[model samples]
Target: MSVFETGQTVVRRDVHRSGRVWSEQALRVVADTSEVLVAACVHGAEARWPALYAKARDDGDRSVRTEAFEAMAAGEWELAAAVWQETDLLLWKPPATWFSVNAFFVPEGDGRRLRNWYVNFEHPAHRTEAGFDTFDLTVDLVVTPDLTRWEWKDEDDYAHVRRLGIVSDTEPGPWTPPATRCWR
Candidate 1:
């Protein structure tokens, strides 16, 4: 097991099961231990995202995101250069867990304020030389910064990906859907 030092730069790569890179972002390590890796990215951090995902974010068009899911179903998509904007992100990933918890901070008066807590349901982290790799399973949980309200996001995409065989019974681990875990 490789250990990362605080303030060191590392690359987080989202990998498709087909042995292809889906997206990549640069993050700075905040804390590292045998249990979890904590990393963060501030505004203007460089990232590469799926073009259609980028379009959806830029244009606020939901259909573009649907198209991205379709492209993922087909295992073909283009990458676009993007920058982290408007917020600072801190991510906590336990190497053996099926999810990562993220906190997004937006600029407030003189500093930043917690915007929300985002839990991304995904494969457990696979440590790499650069940073770590994981596959996003599409569904996510969004919670208020104060932990009062929470919502599930992208159930439609999760269903779509499951139907397209992007996520199936044979990925890895004893992971189950967030819905099953949280509500049941």
Candidate 2:
């Protein structure tokens, strides 16, 4: 029998990026069977600097490491320094049909945990035999975990992409409220 059933609420005990069960979090099973298990609201932390450095050194994406190295060479050590120490927890919900939400938890030093929450609104995930994939929608909402303050991130980039016909303006209004409620 399959471990999970369709429409069942379960916790993901695996890392989405690495496909290793490093931790677990409550999620709703959108589709589950012997072949594959697709879920929503799975959350986990990603090692920031190490992954970036590795990607830059090994993977095709060199921008992250390049920026860090350039910053370090220019004597702007702070920019590159934090990229090595800080981690980010991503609260992700793979959409059933409409859109997906990714809320990032950034770390703050000095014994204060009042870090930033970066919410990315994106397209609904496409699950394949290998895994899942999703594209960024350009615009994003940035808010604290407490929701006391909020703003928009990458408006210019979003507009540019829209102008290029890469993505359309779709409201991610439905996802945020529940996330805020759950975090509180």
How many pairs collide in each candidate, listed in order? 0, 0
lDDT tens string, model 1, 31-140?
Answer: 99988899999999999999999999999998899889889879889999999898899999998888999999999999999999999888888999999999898888
For model 2 the TM-score comes to 0.43
- Predicted candidate 2 versus true structure: per-residue lDDT over 80-165, tens digit per residue: 11121243333444344344434443444653353566666654545543344454554667677677887776565555545654
lDDT leader: 1
Model 1 alpha-carbon miss at residue 8, Å: 0.8
Model 2 RMSD in angstroms? 11.6
Q: In TM-score terms, which candidate is top?
A: 1
TM-scores for all candidates: the values are 0.90, 0.43
Candidate 1 Cα misplacement greater than 4 A, ranges? 170-184
